[model samples]
Target: MMRHLLPLLALLAAPAFAKPDADTRAWLARTAELSSDAMEGRDAGSPGHARAIDLVERWFKDARLQPAGEDGSFRQTVPLHEVAVTSAEMRVVAPDGSAVPLKFLHDITPRPATDLPATLGGAMRFAGYCSAKEIGAEAGPALQGKIAVCFGSRRTGRANGAERLAAVTAAGAIALLTIDDVGFLVEPPRWPDAYARSVAHDGVTLPSGLPQFRVNGAALATLIAGSGRLAAAILTDAGLHRDLESFDLPGRFEAKLTTSQRKFTSQQLIGLLPGTDPAKAGEYLLLGAHIDGYGFGEPVNGDALYNGTLDDAAYVALISQLAARRKGKGFARPLLFAAWTAEEKGLLGARWWLQHPTVPKDQLAGVINLDQLRPLFPLKALTLHGLGQNTLADTAKAVAEGLKIGIRPDLEPERNLIRRVDSWPFMEAGIPAVNFIFAFNPRSQEERLYRDWYVRRYHRPQDDMTTPMDLDAAQDFNRFFYLLVETAAHAPETPRLSPKPGT
Candidate 1:
């Protein structure tokens, strides 16, 4: 009687496979609020941020995932500093007794908001795109003891736009700011300066200094007008291929700034899916996404919240749903499900986790990072974002083709999407991680249809689940993801990471 009951209990206790429904849509829909302007971009340590974390925790519980963080609590406390720039008093002084006062938070907002006694009468240095120019002996002018004013653009399409801001700040520049150089008819809803940046690994390192901050459009515009030579230094037919070396905006301007800032602690949400195969249970597979987004930046369509709708809220739902489905099903290894914190603060959460994982490096298998939900084009084919590096790329291809899904190779690697998602840490550690994405391209008539539809409702205040969500598509992709995981796990031995390109 005891043996018979054991089998029945085991069968009944199995996890439920995720099902797509209005309920699932509703579950995902809540994230928009967390990303909404009211939440102020969900910066790591804000009250609104805590609210988002709470919602994610509730979802994990509802999905039946065992607490993957400390002491049966799904929260892994990651101490972080929440830098808030309460106010700034900055201005420009001309040759004459003319005086112009600049808005502090409006003119500049840094990575770590500062709280100095609201005054920095530093000399002003005019830096053009912050590039080193090649010309006569005096071309490479040095910037010291002065605030360096440079364009926000740096390293092209591969880096987070915040980086150039961060770099200059690190170089001892007292103040930092940027302006729009690209042309996008429909600017980002709230995060006007946001890089639709899908790849790259930055600090994710524990932040050590104040995030030298600056304001968006309004302040930047004021500076440009004062800059005078702004047009020739930045807006010429420089051609995309030629480097803008030596293009310095030569002039002397007096700059000063004053502000108040605050800092706080942030945390990472983590959990685990113990594998069924005992022999390989020690090895691991990781899934992750940054849980924080731009709480607020520029205003969009009369709305000021930079809710990262698809920026990453979609990934949190995707992971929660996937974890609930795969837990104890048939995985043979420990699969770590991580919801990183303060990613926008320079990969604060993920960088920290990579260096301090629960398992050792040798025990790691691979990683899968989800950044946003690609509701457009619906994956007519599986296009591996990073296709040149390893065997995992081939494995992804085989899985997609075996499943009869078309395999469209990465069309433009110049975009360098390989490092775009949170998968960079795993991939950098040689763990063969891959990013699964559904992207929108407006250049093509065919692609534009989806691009227009998806981008229009993608990240704004209007990014709720009420409009045009296709459950069938979501379910289909989830199914594909499930099978891919199964194939990797059920392999006779750990899948080899020595995979070459074109496999």
Candidate 2:
């Protein structure tokens, strides 16, 4: 009787262990609240988004996180502009003076450079992938006063459309054309009406006096007919051998673009956890997640709102949870929690933060970004984007390994996942940054689930609260992320950008 009584007393004296189900249920509750119809998809600058801001601010306040924004508030305002092509006309002239008229949305899509309408024309030049190294020294003179054409894909490395446009525009090109294969469409299927909406971004002037168009295979064939090289042959060679050869086309191109513009403001929510060490507190680690989604768009299956549950709402909740868990805990360096706006609009909010950081830019040690993480399968492995690009990879690997989770490099580099998230802005600003995704073995059912999610739910209305989820997997990942953040914040030395040699 005495021995049994002692055992019971020992159990009672120990601290209560948190049940896994309870934690998962709490997280799901938050996700459901954020993804509910009442949020209206949390579109940036909309009343729904305003409600989201209020909700997150309340959460931060509840967690007792110190306000890190200007004027001792939890909000930072970002000024932006929306640019869209209202109407566009294009004509490709052959050497024989035969003109081919291209239809909008069917043959090509015009991405306006500014809000102004103008007509521009020039001789055509096929610049392959328009890679800076491929273009070489003579490209400046050759591309001048010409419409430079190239393949629009990740085969050109980090230089995507906007980057390529900036390069050619700087080289004096009057216009740019990119050939995109239908198989590489990034967004979900949409009707012609979707093109009527403009894209938003920070109000930065475009690099050059050139407009860019993303044309399909049909339009490419028409533009390259007079060049003696078949568009099909060029595309086939590039696809098969992954090599592109630049050449001069024996024709000219003309475009008349009309655009409309609107200016508006959005807010990024920021909170801080000051470090215990005064010396290291000035230096900070940034953790970020985008809070905006496609407000209301083309409906699918009788649903219209894109709640973005897995896309980012979960991670934002994770940030709030961490702040609550770590309250009053001592740390070497400060932890900055940021909920960015307009990530779907081309990483605009993150970019704005880089330009106008809440903390001094130089003191920023590293950034950990969370975007579009889906845990549909068991958490056996983790995918770390920008792995080996910095010392942070080592820290992430160590934490994952301790938890018996394998760490893998980005498997789908062709998707340009590294540049697509909020971390990219910090990386571009010369700071070490990393983003995460769940990993699965090759040819496994988990892989199938991952692929199916992208096809059926990514950027779609189907990504709402009603979608089936693996809350256990989500809870496990949240634990891993929390450990990773704590490790980085308390490390003796902050993570730095130290790329592997020859990378």
Candidate 3:
């Protein structure tokens, strides 16, 4: 009895362990290589990212995937242009003529405009939520020549950033400053931004002259200090999405801005595995993950590299691992394995590919994008984007159920994350697509870890190899992904978007 009791106690004392298999171990090893500091965070259009592209191409070649890129090569050059803010200075001139300086990158960060002026300023006016619907009549002559200040919130039904920009721009405001919303805890704003930069495809133009800026939420009180309005009260109202009244501030905004521009190119690596069935060979399923990260940035906690391990490097490695496991074998439908670039710079690579697909657009059946697949805790359920909107949902559900993993629709729709990821472009093109997030029970340890990840390491250098990850969870998700790919690719009918009403 003593011997039996001793064994039971030992087992109970030690936590449950799920050992990673050889394949998962290999997958992580590859992830570490891609996200290593030596890769310089793999920023798009950087030398480091070019090196990563080569590595992925080599991996695909080793897996026996045929080149399906430009001119029968596994490389597609994505034309890109970048603008970096080298310097910026802003001041709030009080009615009495005293100026309060705003710290660059601390109190505010300017979005470098395509036609940014050397200097510009105007009287400041609060524009409530700044939505066209919200601003209604006030957006006309009332905002014609002044700078408009708006609250940035992700609360449901609130206009998104683009709509807000259009509303303020159309109102003839010279500039727009959006105060960061601190209420949104799903993904709170990070202060002292790494840098200020804008990237877009070559030849694409933006709304010129109307510069944009983001004000730190903590500094809102300072901006409204002498306006006779209580900052706390206004902030509380904004945080609660309460109706706010537009008002003129006690000061005029003065500013100086400087920027530098450069043009460079990036690569989108695409490899193909032809289908085994002659009939289904005409169709294809695309598997994609971004290979770019934040690259070099202002030092954070004495570190400056944003390795983007789980943000996408790991998932890119997972794709490579999948290729290796297949060893050149084809599914019922062809598989187009794509490693995208410039995703951090606003999904440029994927968007470009959508416009210039290596395979015929009509033959592309579905897209499965891997990004921000945080495996920080146990993988019990998956929060799927595009969950009931298409046939891909059924395949994902079946695959997840067979693995004993629960599947559910996104419960946090207010975040609007679906439109922010790489899969959005494909989904918008009318192709069925899906993305995933590891789900956790509220108020649980897993929830704590998940939320903490966003605050401490989401886009920071802290997301390096040293960051803690649940190996068991990683392995489980890897298995689920591998099976999901197989199940989706082998299904008799290719995935398609669910029919809409009146279609």
Candidate 4:
């Protein structure tokens, strides 16, 4: 009898095939439509993004969601200013009076400064990781009038990006050159960027730091040729966070930089799904996903369009599908569906919405952000960003367990991925919020797929719809998210922030 029941139980479990169900099919169809080349990668403030907005507004209307944006409209305009580098040229002036021209995007990609100079030149000085401790007391005199080259990798015990900047700036460096770390297999460096650009909220002041650049790993050899240090050894040591000595390279770093500036406006789509119970209707839960991608840039394998199929377009479609499924029904608390813009430029869209909320900020009970989720493999587990930091974790775990999916806190905290997504703004505002990443076992094929996606497709034109996807995995995650939202929205008590230390 027990053996017979075991077989029956297996039949009742969710299928593990690669085919998608009707619901997943619809969600994927929407994703394909939004991430197609016709959408021009949906860059924020671009015509492509405008079309995306129109499509989403229609979806919201069809789903019976109420207009909950500015002045009762389903759209909230966000003003933004953009700066793009039009031309860049760098050359190495070797001590022996030889000049070698470095390819712009191939050899190095410079971060365009707000107050960019037409030309920059300085002697080359390497300061290992450029950490405060490594720079030492004489850093000021050592790096002055030189271009400080540092290892670019954020590690557990090393000084972070901001600290490195302060240290180098205080040392009077004319500019900074950071060799991109190659050992971070999770997200390796991919050279030949589409373009260098920056976007900021309109009327906001942009930082005027020293002009900085990322040197391609292959180009490191050229930068350190006469320093008597092997580029491979330097990168190997840097990857392990080992201490390295500082030295001046036998070259003068020179560059010519040119940029174009423009100002434009983007809009965030906001809609409200009303609740059935009047008592809990006053409280709200927000579900958000960014709908922007890198519009166009330098071509890769002859494709210049950066179709962000999974980066976020797929998740945006997921939220739309959720709204459509709950079209005629209601949870206890109202649900806010947000299609954020300019997420690629920073968390500008979400940040702006937080600053100018459509509903009372205090009424927002919790948030579930959908981004950085990759269903390349079976959805056996999930990595929750704010797992132990909020009360939402319990609800999320309960829902996930019902679907047989394991829930765990971030396993890669060194990446600081938790604070990099849109939910962070809500978390900062004392609201319970959570974001997710599909988990994979160490040394498993699933891990390979996950890491490969980050290396080959992430933030690249190769992230188009042609990439293979595990439809079953996608469907499982979809179901899990839908149930999670339903559980949170119907809970008798609203989710609250966990108590902070000393509180």
Candidate 5:
């Protein structure tokens, strides 16, 4: 309802801007300690994440939150496998038999490959992007055992490089060597840094097959420098023309690779607060935040510990505080609090729970997801993550209005936030879910405090609870989130998926 939030910020901010409060400072301290350099980026399958989860589970016990996990434990187990590149060797030789070898992880990344080998000999066809339009007319048994020179658009676009490379592997093509397309510009193109960080950390080894390769744009350009024809010219040629002979050099080749899948496990921390109503005590209100961060580094950014502070530790601390407050108060519906493990690894903890829930998934009314807590843009109007999936948004908006805050739609619908957090698994299992954040739009006092104070302390080592935070606002936001949990749990009528559907 932050109905008057805009004007309120204007009236409340210091004339020249000011500092945050105590609660925020404390929250920041806990946040810093959790995601600090000492913690090494709370990775899913790493010791760092294990310690973080253990600490959280201990705190949950100390808070007197009931044990609400499988059997009598406060933890859930998730299993995973990794497919890594073990050993590899690649070379480009001419008809004259001169060798042109490339480095394995450097000169060309094998890009993820299948678990088989491929050999192609005859005429190498330069397939531009492997697009139907480019290679549509070049159908030939000749392409059956030959190489295909195409340009992978890199990580910046919708062009599924891995998927397309997979087709080459299936086609039994010796190998696929691609370059950057002009559209593959330098903006880094909205890559999935979050998931990528996690997957890279939880790095796996896969089987070998028709592998893929990509060179840096400049190095690729340099590789093409002496060539008389442009890449597109050779790739799109209709006939196996003599002019395109350079790209067809040493048409016969064999590519072999083997990536073995390996197994590993992690734990999810769970605790509960019993319900007040005898009848609905069996029902549950699920609240969650991921305790894990990127475990290991990938090829792109070598940051080992993906110490995720604002990404989620803040939310965990917030949930922990709520548990402390409600432990004695008693909720109408049982409260199931979770600090997930391996969340970065494809929400494995959540997925595991859905497959083996402590309580029947059908009895659950809804889920409240806590991931990022920073007011990224000083939310003028709170944005609903799933647009219109639940009345929870309406309830949240109503609360905001009551608090004189505003409400708005999400900036990016394509992101599908509702499906990205822990709440998503529950929603998929048929429960309502919502993710809320502290936002300051319309340049409110809160928004001002954020830019003037919160941003720098965000995910960095500085996110310590001691760092100056707007404690008052933190209290308000945390309480507001807790209220949502309380209201949904105790309300005479359960929160439901809005008629139109929401998240």
Candidate 6:
């Protein structure tokens, strides 16, 4: 009789476990809606982006979230200026005074300054990998008043492109040129079309008036041949060692760029769910995701739309789901949900918020940013950006443990991912923040899937509604996220940045 009753109980519970919860279903539907073709990839300042914003606003209203933006509105405007190259001509002048014409988008890609002059010319100087220390010491004077040429990719600890450009221009360099070396598993590099469309904040001026160009290896080799320095030898040395020697090359390169400019504005959507506890409600927990992606661009596989389903739309959907889940029953701390814009345009929206926050910056407890959450594998582990930087990591660890999910460190820390997402601006503003990514073991099927998705779908039209997803993994992670927020909200104290030892 006991065995018969056990079988009957198992049969009775089957239906409860058969279907996904209402929240998970709603999340998936919202993701599909956002990634639909009608959204036009949700590019900033575009009609499709406007529709996307309206959709999010509707979701917020339906969830009964309070407007937390400027003037009790849900929109925060971000002014932006866009510059695109209309025409370009470049030549490498040999030591013998012969000129070799370089082709655009093939041999080299020109990145004109936002406010460029009608015509420009300079003698090219090879500054090797222009590290900050090198620029401050030897390369600074050497790069003065010339077109500074340097390696595009650098090893860890070196100044990135923006930093290198700032240092070079401050050193009085007239222009900048970067040569691309072949990277691991990314051969015959495909230059990004974004160089043709440069966007920047309208009020923020660049460090210099230098026009920059990223030349292909073959083109750089052509220029290096005249300098009596073999390109292969330089590349081999740079590849073998972390640091390389800087020197003055033997050529004068000239480039002229014609550009067209336009000014436009995009908006960041913000909403608030007030906490049940008024004392803790004063300090808010920020949750955010970028709602923009590359608009229509060069078509791949007969598709021009970059739907960005997993690139960001999925996470934005998660935001809506969370808002709806806690609508009537609020947490202990208020929740601030922000759908950021112009993230692909250099994190402008987040930076703008840092400059103009809805509430006082100190009133913020911490931030959890979501972007490009592709749930293609099981939820065994998660990679938390800025993991050990603050007390939030402790909360996250506890929550993940309760859910039986492992918390892992960023595997590709060399990518500088912490500074690459929406959380960076908050971190720079002295706010505690963290970003999440699904984790996979080294060289496993999960790793292979992640690599394949990045190579094929990331920033491409292939990341559309049709892309396969692991729904169970997504639901599990969503559950963990919901619980994590509740745990943080009810904690005795707001999350704070952890001080380094001996500080």
lDDT of 3 by residue, 230-339 (tens): 87787789888898888888788878988888889999899998889899877799999999999998788888888888878999999999999999988888999999
**True lDDT of residue 194, candidate 2:** 28
Give the candidates in order of TM-score, highest first: 4, 3, 6, 2, 1, 5
Model 2 lDDT per residue over 204-265, tens place: 76423566677766677788776678877877765554667777887788778777777888
Candidate 6 stretches with Cα past 4 Å from truth are 1-22, 91-107, 121-125, 131-146, 157-173, 184-190, 225-233, 242-252
Cα lDDT, all candidates: 0.55, 0.76, 0.86, 0.85, 0.59, 0.79
lDDT of 1 by residue, 1-503 (tens): 23223432342233432355543444344444445445555667677778788877776666556666766677766655433333344555655446566644434444433233234554455454553332112322344445565544423442234555455554565554454343222332124333211112232332334324444444443454554544443534222323443222232334333333334567678777777878887667777877887665445566555566666776776777776665445476667778888776656677776766655668777776777456544556656754556566667777877866776655544445556567776777777777765543447653664455445555454443233444455556666776777777666666456645465
Candidate 4 or 6, higher lDDT?
Answer: 4
TM-score for each prediction? Answer: 0.72, 0.76, 0.93, 0.95, 0.71, 0.84
> Which of the two, 2 or 5, has more TM-score?
2
The clash count of every prediction, one per candidate, is 40, 0, 0, 1, 60, 0
| lDDT tens per residue, model 6, 225-337 | 55667888877776665566777767677777788878899988999988889788678899999998887876767777888888799898898889888775678888899
- Across residues 220-267, which tens digit of lDDT does each residue of candidate 5 receive? 433343345554554334212212232433323333444544567777
List the lowest-lDDT window of 10 residues for candidate 6. Answer: 3-12
By lDDT: ranked, best first = 3, 4, 6, 2, 5, 1
Clash-forming residue pairs, model 4: 194-298
**Model 1 quality (TM-score):** 0.72
Candidate 4 lDDT over residue span 314-381, tens digit each = 98999999999988577888999999999988899999998899999999999999999988888999
Model 6: lDDT of residue 76? 94
Candidate 2, residue 37: Cα displacement in angstroms equals: 3.1
Candidate 2, position 344, lDDT: 83
